[model samples]
Target: MKKSYPFLVLVFFSSCWSYSQSIATSPYSLYGLGSLYESNFGLTAALGTAGIALPSEEFINNKNAASLVNIPANNFFFEIGGTGIQSSFEDNVRKENRNNFQFSHMAFAFPITARSAFNLSLMPYSSSSFKISGLKIPIIDGNNEYYYLNVIGTGGLNNLDLSYAYRLNNKLSLALSASVLFGNTTDERTYSISSSTTSIDKKVNYSGIRPILSSQYKMTSSLTFGLNVKSPTRINANKVQSVTVENGSGSSFLETDKKSDIDDFYLPLDIGVGISKSFKNKFNVTLDYEKSYWDSTNQSDMYASFSDQEKFSFGLSYQKAKTARNYFNRIKYAMGAHYDTGYLEIDNKKIDDKNLSVGVSLPLDHLSSSLYISYTYGSKGQITNSLIQENYHKLTLNLNLDGIWFVRKKLE
Candidate 1:
């Protein structure tokens, strides 16, 4: 335990810095918020699960506001969940992992004036937590701990959005929402050399803001269309520095010394369409197509740069009327798929990966309780570039809980 104290201190105290941004630069800064939520089953069912324009009817599906319109009137909603990632790199050289938990959304919807309903929600717009570790065996020395590198980071971007929906005719509904995003990130790392009591420690801190617009249109009782446009955003990370030591006698610290431009670049653009059909109100099948505009993002101050091609996806669900104990609600089974051309480019070659997942959801009475569990597997195919060709597989588990509190109204 005493030997590991220095490494822990290095990881915790190093993340204090800032950077600049600009519009002419790449909008890749948006990727820093965190990995989007993708269920193992959802990856196989749709395009990254990012283009959901409408909400679900049984509950607030987290995909679109349109799904909220189907919710029972005069009821509130809330949701919370967490995800874990266990990843591996090529040749077993690099490994990244993390376990994270957060609240997804909290909102209440009720009739305002006429046929219109308004919902105000506090939810996580984005989030990310990942770690990387590598070990090197000395060719000359036989030390058990020759070389080690450890990187750790944790933070999230969130937003408060206002949504409204109006029932036009019987078979058609339209909805719109506006959201603002705010979040920050902190990263720390330690590198040790072989045959010497020397090491280097680094730290970084960053923050930013973004605005988003989303909407959905229902064409028929069994079909719906979704659309979302996220404007350009900029993240500024400043006060970067590096610390080096030799023989544990003296310490030297140096500032990163790089100046940044603070401007906004359009984040990736996303579009998708979905169709669902119900059989005797017992079971339903849903299919969708999504396109992500990674080309719009040209640069990033926090991560590597690349051209991410558009991706594709699909999904299916089975629901039944079943009862459980006080904690259990209705049970639902779901499966999905997702594919994307990675955003980073090496040697002008595009990187890509695919995902597969399955999940189960439980609806708790009017209180709105739910639980979903999924796992994902991804591999980066060889690109045209000549660099460290690496591929990885990630396992993710997500758990969620949602409920509402009424100050004056009667319970359902």
Candidate 2:
């Protein structure tokens, strides 16, 4: 096999010197990215929500672990993708933004004797960030006064994950993943009133570890079952700092001197099922169903404990291995849809989540080479009894490249 030495060196050194910049963050971290098996986004989430499974075959296939046992040695897979989001408040205000570039995934699989094999991968775990700002004026007394308020929020929950999988047999396999969570958040709020100006800023930083277990089984020629459990984690936000300033002197009135209490919680769990069948004419179809337990997560406050979220998805595809048509006719076409009942915990209130998505995958001449892309639109259902509810929408695109560098000869 011919190794991409330059790419390998780049990948290695980059990993070694990876630094945690304390300047920014994202809102997507609340829900896991690469949470779903495919690179496609969920109907409700720009890049799909956590818990969805992918195929587990020779391709480093997503779900169905048992399939990994059949994969050949010296296999490598790489994926890259991004998501864009547009948020709207009430019906008049519009907010649009995009997340940072992400390294979707990279994996290596090797043979252990004949029946068993091992696989390892590096992928993203979660990402989250959001900012809301508005101007407000208040009257403190009967006298004519001028006051302006500005609020800003910044941070993203990001995770780095490492995983290993062992195929027990042709029909079953087990996999485990260890993830290190790292990120920080900063909130800036300023109020200018009449002759005085006040500013408040808060920053929180955290580090922790989490784990995931997975299992897959093939029930028949057309049906497969998969399960994943994300262990709980106790993240230590040791640095919850705050600063307050008054007037034009630029002097500090108050500042935090110590860290806040440590917080810990479960990461939630997912269950999924898949079906793949072939038709007489060589056509193929695959479908997926998955469920997530957001309710199991520990809330930070009463408002945050209001409701839990759930998701559902479906995908279909058509492939022509060999056709009499032109070159493009040999490719495969696919589309999918995803839905979610948005999870919530606002002032002990529950909110609804709904979304829709579609995507496609194209195969290359070498079979392993392929391209994929998907997009989604959704909203956080009406907040009960509220004057107005908020809505959110997003788009996502992904590209994948994989191929065998060397193959063992049949008669070697």
Candidate 3:
């Protein structure tokens, strides 16, 4: 098992590279930074992505870095996970279906000392993949004529984070983390008229950094409270554009090439709070609330306006204490739900999302390594005012491995 660790890591990274190429598919992704991805993974995801205040000795909780201090000394925790989405979209006129599978996240956590812990992770910050077409307009050029326009967009961003957590006392823990965000997106628009076609391609590149502060308090043995804050960030933006025209005889020619600087993109401050309680080690429940002050930024994209965003989450888990008995008794079952008033507003309507999820975790070996699987069913937006409504089902898979990374050797 020790020798296979290197090979496993290599395979995991390679798979991540391949899957990252296409992470999401949604028409709503055409706006802003694309579809914002959830940060939950593994056990947290199984618990309905509501683990901010939950503490675990056997798992790594990325939601609240302060929880890292709860990990047992000398134990190294690693997680790799991915998601598969099946989605259907509909408007008043028509419906369409799309599906995607992609890597979700990878992380590692270990104790730096008895009082401090360290964690590092990589995950998608957002994803954009959408195509829109069938836009027809009449031209009154002496003779009545019609033209069509089609638009396609793709790409997204990724985040790399490094965090540290310290146990300040018996009841309180604190954490700080920094993340580097980077990505590129491409948008192409094509116009068709009179057997000739013209296309314009625009590409935007983004890079930024943000800092987060987190804290967890053990109010009592059965109850805990957590809070986190992310500061606002400014992302530098640059654009490269090109235009091409194709004639009726199938000859294509470049029309223009340009590079320019765009306005700096702004991200708003985000705050989250959560609480969790355990019932006799058999049942656990958690509740969480988060808000982003997008309205404070006063930012707007070309097609959509920004609104303050809020999310509420709830989760429950059940498991039997380990005993020399059936294997099923050791498995954990979890369920959760969440509702979000999204940040994007179009035509005086806000895009919203709601989801319900259920999951199971199967212990793999004596070291507390486990396989986690979860499913979420959700809907986003509404079919009103010619807007699209999205219904989706997502499946998540994760492998959590715990081992001893560094050990002292004794010689005779």
On TM-score, the candidate that comes out on top is: 3
lDDT of 2 by residue, 251-313 (tens): 666766446764544455555655555465344445555555666664543113423455565
Q: Once superposed on the true structure, which residue ranges of model 3 sit more than 4 Å away at CA? A: 1-20, 138-146, 193-196, 246-257, 322-325, 409-412
Q: Tens digit of lDDT per residue, candidate 1, span 1-412?
A: 0111112212212222122111101112223344443322112222235336434644444455545556555455444333444333222133322232333345555544344556666665444444445534343444554566655555555566677766665555556766555555455556667533333333334455444444556666555666545545555544344455554555654434334333443356555566655555445566556566666676543323545456555666665554545434357676667777766543344556677756666554534445555554555544222322233333333333333334377789
Candidate 2 residue spans exceeding 4 A from truth? 1-58, 61-70, 85-126, 134-149, 191-196, 248-250, 256-262, 269-298, 322-326, 347-349, 383-395, 405-412
Candidate 3: Cα lDDT at 43: 69
Ranking by lDDT: 3, 2, 1
Instruction: Name the lDDT value of residue 236 in candidate 1.
Output: 52
**Candidate achieving higher lDDT, 1 or 2:** 2
Go through the candidates in order and give the C-alpha RMSD of each one to the true structure: 9.4, 10.8, 9.1
Model 3 RMSD in Å is 9.1
Residue 228's C-alpha lDDT in candidate 3?
89
Q: Is candidate 1 or candidate 3 better by lDDT?
A: 3
